[model samples]
Each structure stands twice: as structure tokens, then as C-alpha cells.
Target chain A: MEIEIERNLVMPGDVVPCPTGSMPGYGTYQNEVGEIVSNVMGYPAMYNRLVCVNSLRGCYIGETGNVVIGRISQVGNKRWKVDIGASQEAALQLSSIDLPTGEHRIRSEEDQLHMREYFNHNDLLSAEVQSKSQEGKAINLQTRSSKFGKLKNGMLVVVSPNLVARMRQHFCQLNNEVDIIFGRNGWIWVYYNNTNELEVPLIRRQQIVRISCLLKLMNKALVMISPEKIQQVFERTSDIELEDLLAESTLERIKDIDAVE
Target chain B: MTEEILFYGFRQDGRRPGELRQIKIKLGVVDNSSGSALFQIGHTSVLAFIHGPKQTKHEKESGHIHCYFNTAYFSSSGERRKFSKGDKKSNEFEANVRTMFESVVLMENNPHSDIDIHVLVLADDGSVECAAINAITLSLIHAGVPLKDFLVSCSSGFYSGMPLIDLTYSESTSFQVISEYRVAVLGKSLQIAYLNYDDIGGHKLTPEVVREITAMAIEGCKQVHFIMKQELQNACSN
Candidate 1:
């Protein structure tokens, strides 16, 4: 089926054109006269019978089943509060994580006493959103699988969540010997595998910085991010010096490249 | 005084009875704020910043809005004077602006959250309340907060048996003017959100005069709404 795409720039209080039986989504409201009006300054996108406006800039709105990286802000009796850069801190319950010993036993008071040993305040971890509260004020997070756990020996880069595209595989090991974790919440982790060896090559460190600079540039330009685009930009900028990648001329060049696509 | 206040059908600024001052709005002027905007109406200027939609610490309500109105010591007429935090006039203005916004913004959508609006007057030529309202509206738009409609405000006064629209500070405070009123309305629905008389004790306004002044104020608000809508669209397109 061929779907027709209609995009229009709209501002607050502007009456949007909606056909009968069409439903208004986010950034839109129906007035008393039954006309759909925009409630934000953004681009209105139409999909079949549904219309929604995508704002130019906004805070991250979390969703269920999305992998996110967060810092532990508070350790409570049975739950830990994680700051994922959302409107509200997410709750990570003691019952949601698996012990390091790989035991499936029930959580006890003794386990609560040892919660600090597993995770301390300000410790970073990756987990999936399990559920949201009835009022949508709080999110429940779970990290039962091995892939979701505490992060160690990594540098985190924060960007707008809108830049990060949701994908199946957010974790990748680049050919340059650096591992990257692209958190759906727009926090990226770059680190070397210290478990295998303590010393990382100087070339690997340069590549990591290059990738980070590229990501920052793309975010500044508000380009939709994807793994392919990152790899392509990295390949195209290989001729530029590492320190010069963030210069005004280089950023302008990157923006031009993004515009072309 | 009457002849000087109204010259041939024009106000002191050479504007017609219904003409408004030039309005300029720029969004995202303050990079550190979640959202900020600088709004200028003729010589009057105000900068507004919005921070939040985050977790509320004390209030258990679904959504809470806090507003602060401040004027620089040099913003007023004549010599500079130190301002106290407990100044009654500033506090009253803050409370009024906060209540007006709380009515238009869709607070129920953001439960357990608070939105703070801080407005600073950079210049005060006339109609500071109206300028502050416009600045806050643009700032909220930059923040991407959901709203029912754009709340636009304007000031008008009855002078020389005619209603003058978008009055300047001089025109509003002139002894020849009978009454001056500030009005705010929601653009989409044209619903009145706020209305107040700057000075009502000196003269008793007839029903017909009150009705005419209100109609003129609403007209001025509509004009402001058009300019604000255009500016918001310009911000999004580029």
C-alpha cells in the first residue's frame, strides 16, 4: 500500500486540518468546535487517520521495554531510585535484579542489608523499564538478564533523547577495539574491555574521541541518529585531525553532510 | 491636559486610538534555561524563563505552577532604588500572573510536577503586565509545555471620551484618563482569563464606557496573538 505523507509546520493555537474520524495524538487538542488544534510549535505528521506533532526540543519521555542507563540517586529499604533524565526518577526494586551468585532464591532482610554492596549511590547501571505507575508518575525498572547490570570503566556522554533511535542491538563493539552502549535515553557509554587487558592502545583512544565528537555534532544538528549514519560519518572524517574534528569549520562540514542526506 | 492627551485623533505616540506598539519576540534567548524568551513591546521589554515539569518536592497536587515577577532597580522611572523581596506591588503582580497561567496550561497532564516561571522586566515604558504576559506565553511555548491556547494580554484606557488601545505608561497614568484596565484572553477560544482595573477608585465608569474599553482591550489582545503565532511558527520552521 502506498501511504501519502503530509507534513506541515504548525504553532500553538493554530487550527489543524483533520478529516472526520481522524484522531488527534500528542501535541494536539480538540477545541469545543471539534477542530483539532496544535498545542506546540512543531511539525505536524499524519499517519493514516492519526495526526501527531513532533516538537523541536523536549525532555525525554520514557516508555516500557526500552533499555536505559541511569545513575542510582537513593537506596531505600527495598527499592533504589535511578535518575534516567526523565521527569521522575525510576524505581529499581531489590526483587527485580539477580544476585551475583546466580541464585533464584527469594529476597530476604539479609539481602536488603547487603544492597549497598551490589549498588551504591551514584553507581551507573543499565536496565529495561518493566512498568509504569497508574498515574504515569513513576517507572519500575528490572535488570534480570546478564546484559543489564552495573557499568564499570566507561565514559558517559549525554545528549537529547530525540537523537537516539530505538533499535534491537544498542550495544556494539567497534573494529577499533572500543565498546559502545547507546542508551535509548541518549546517554552513551564508551569504554575499553579492561577485563582482557589493562593497557588500551593510543589509536583506540583516538577513535573513541572521534566517535564521541561525531555524535555531539549530529545531535547539535538535530539529525536522526542511526548506526549506519554514525559509521558513515566516521569513515568520511578519517582524514581530519582528531583535535580539529570539533572546530567550527569541521562542524559546519558535518552539518552540510547531514543536510545532504 | 485633554488637548495634549488626544491630538487630532492620535495619541501622544502618534498612534491611532486602536493602534498597538510594535511587538518583537525571540525564543531561546537564555541557553541555560529549559526555555526562555525576550519580548519587546515598543520600548517596554521583559525576559521570561521556564524551568521544570520535573518532580515537585512539597506539593502533592498533580501539577503546580510558581511564578516570580522582578523589576531591575533601573527599570523604573527616575533614580535607581533598592528593591526588597517583600515588596507588596511586585508580590501582587507575581501572584496574579501565576494564577492566570495556571488556568490556561494543561496541568492535569503532568501529574506530580511543577513548572516555574521567572519574569524580569528589563525596561518599563508602559503596560508592564501586558508585556510580562506575552513574554511568559512565548517562554512556555519554547519549553514545549502543552497548553489549551495562547494567552495574550493588553492594556487600554478611556481618555477624552474615547477608548485608547495599548496605552503607554504615560497615557495610562495621565490624570485626564477616566479609567485604565488590563485584560488577558485565550486566543483560540477568546475566553477572558484575567481582567483588572489599574485605578478604579478615582472615577466611576459608566456601563457603556466600561464595555467599550473592554472591547478595545480584547482587540489589542487579538493583535498580539497574531504576532505571537507568527513568531512561534518562524521559530519552528528554521
Candidate 2:
């Protein structure tokens, strides 16, 4: 039997009261697919909150206060701006930086603030959103805590914007290790197992895009997502994670490319 | 009989051309939205949400409230919709929705603050503009954003020589001689915010046709206004 779950609506774990004419248990899910157990169903209405299905749910994007892998773009007298992918540039205040001075120094405009000495442009750093504004605007961020700031070794991936938003929400709720930074435009930066260095950025990018594209296709049926093709991208990142289908020669060829990069 | 069959005697749904389909409305469907509602006018189903009327920071743009209308065709039939740059017609619909809300919403009340209205379409049948206008207004009410009065809107299209009150999926299809009227009604004042037309017939369609269509459209607005007021009253009473 075929079963369908409504889109965009958030359904809670609690049982829903059947609508006036709706059959009891007809719209509720009994199994993992969240298929409406009841055959009689009402036309899914707009604004209808749906139950969350793991497969149909889209990926999340990074948000304000979200720890993100940001690239240092520009530095100024009082602060340095980091690009966290939100519309506005996230600031890394002079005060936010844990300088080696042992003694905390006060910030003043008169103090010489060179952009390069502090953070040069194109430096892939990490920060969080200080604030969010309308029309995709946001404030610069800083990593005051020990764990935050500057993603030294990781990979970044990009996908459509909607996918990032979905994934971000999910991560926040589930408390997962995948730290995702959603560029307000279209790219996503993820840092998983920061020790892996070169592999993480590429892995995050490929994984995010693949997962997002797949969720979108499954949910909207707007397109078909090839999970096999997505899994293939990981083969180049690590041999241990690769599937058996890829030839040893192909793996060796990818390793040579990785070595050069 | 010529191909120009008269729908005046009967509609596809067996209603008169001047008649509106059934309207079902429910408020507060989204938890994240300050105010939200689901509206179904015949087969067309739309969801509208209102977020904010709160203070807007500089980066958030002005301390005052600004209104934003987002219309997305999420699921149309079995096809998943890609976000287009909002073609001309869609842009016009967005603009009209903005204007209609601007009239009723007391913008000056919350200077430097902004209100956001987002409409997501689950299905599309016909008369999208009217439905969006109605949905946004209801969302505002649901959100409890202060307003001078209820601003309701409706559209009437000219097909052949007859002016239909509200076009259905089939009748609303491209007509040779067609004019679309979108008007916002606030209190006793009626504002013709948008009027689009193509003069296909070999005649300079007089203002009389426009006036007639406007009158019919206003009548539809009044009907919608009544329903909105009743909903507000019910909510207050409860």
C-alpha cells in the first residue's frame, strides 16, 4: 500500500485529533516512513504543520550564534570582519581576540589596527553570528570561548540555500557534531573531525550538497537524487570510507591529485 | 453555437459567473510565525504568515517596521517548483499584495520597525492575487498587528464581452480580450491599486466596462471583509 506524508508541515510526536471528518488514525503514522496509517485522508492544506520524517526532512544551514567556519575578509580599527555566509559580515572585535598580552588591553581607535597582522583577507577562520537582520543582514562574530574561532583543518561544501536552512535547524535540535556554516548566498562550510585537515572541507562540501540535494528531491520530488553518485564523492576523501565499486587505480589517481592540491 | 460559450448561465462548478467559490479559513497554523493562517478558496490553497512588527536594528534595516511579502510555489501538482526570479506576473502579484497591506497597516505606528508577510502556496487553482491579499490580511489580523481597518481585495477579469466576478481555473485561462482589476477596500474608500488589461477586441473598451468590473470586484471584497470581521469577533468573544 502507498502512503504519503504532507510537506512543510511539522507534525509532533503526539497523536493528532482527527479533523471533523477525518478517519481515526488515518492521517497518523504507525511506522518509520510516517505513512498515514489511515487510507482516508484530507487534502493537505497549506500552513498545515506536518510530522517530521527523517528521509523527507531537508538539511540545515548555519545561523546567528551558530559556530561557523568563516573566512577573514576585512579588518578595521575596532574589529575584524569574518564572512560566515550570512548576508552581513560577522565582526571579530579586538576585544573578542585572546591576544598573547597576558594582560587584557583596552580597545581604542588611536591604536594601530593593521588588517594583515591580526587577520589577513582570505584566512578561513571560525566565528558565530552576533545578530541577524532583515533582508539577510547579520553582524560579525567572535569566538570568545576556547572551542570557537578559526577552522584550521576541514573541508567546505556548497549546495542550494534551502537545504542549508533545513539542515541547520535539524542540527540545532539533534545536537550533532557536524558544524555547518551557511553562506547567506549558496555555499555551506562544515567542520567534522577538524584533525583530518584537507579532507574535511571537501567532505563537508560534497556531503552537504549531496544530502541537501537528495532531501530536496525526495521531499518535493522536484528532482531525483542519486545517493550512489553522492556516496562516490567521499571515495576521494578517504579510502576507508570508500565503496568497493571504485577501482584501486581510481583511488590511486585521486590520491595523486590530493597530494598536489 | 460559436466557441464563445456563455458561462453566465452556468459555471464549471455550476455556480454563476459572478459567484465566488467556498472559502475556508483557519488561523495560527505555524508556531514560528507571529501570526499565520491557511486559506482555501475552492481548490486553491495558500498559507500566509506574519512575523514581526517589532523593533528593527540598523542592519536589520531601520528601527521601523517594513513589510515583506514572499510567495513561493512549493508544490504544484506532482512537480516540485524551482524558485524562479519571480516572473513579471509574480512580481506584480507581490507588489499588489504589498500595496494592499500598506493601506490597512498603520506603518507610521511603528516607525523604524518592520512586519514580514510570507505566503507559501501548497496548491494553485486560480485568482492567486485575491487569495494572497485575503491571506495576508488574515495573517495580519492573526498576528494582531495594529491596523487602521481591514483591507480586503478581489479581482475581476473580462472574458469575451462578459466581465466575470472571479475567474476559475478554466475561465481564467488566457482570453483574447481580457482586463484584470485589483482593488483594495479600506473603510468607505476604494483604491484601484492595480489594473492590467489587453484590448484584443476591435473596440476602445470604455471606462464603463472598467467601472462595472471594479464594482463587482468591490462587492467581492465586501463579502470577504464581512468574513474577516466575523472571525475577529469570534476570536475576541472566545
Model 2 chain B: weakest 10-residue lDDT segment is B59-68
Superposition error at B1 for model 2 (Å): 14
Cα lDDT tens digits, model 1, A1-261, are 223335667777887776687778778888777888888877777777777787766666778988899999989999898988776778899999989998999999999999999899999998999999887757899999998899975678777787887887888877646788888888887777667767667877776777788888777666666677777777877789888887777666656555411
lDDT of each: 0.82, 0.52
DockQ of each two-chain model: 0.54, 0.04
Which of the CAPRI classes, incorrect, acceptable, medium or high, describes model 1?
Answer: medium
The alpha-carbon deviation from the true structure for residue A162 of candidate 1, after best TM-score superposition, in angstroms, is: 1.9
For model 1, the DockQ equals 0.54
Q: How do the predictions measure up, each by TM-score?
A: 0.87, 0.45
Predicted structure 2, TM vs. truth? 0.45
Worst 10 residues of 1 chain B by lDDT: B77-86
TM-score of chain A of 1: 0.89
Which stretches in model 2 have alpha-carbon errors above 4 Å? A1-261, B1-8, B59-81, B159-161, B174-177, B191-204, B235-238
> B1-238 in candidate 2: lDDT tens per residue?
1234255477567767677788888877886666788878888778888767543445335443334444455644435567634667667666766665665565643444567778777677767667777787777766645454456777676655576776555555544435445666753344554555533234456788777788888888878777765664454332
lDDT of 2 by residue, A49-134 (tens): 33212211111223566545667766666777665443245667777765533356775554445536656778876555565544
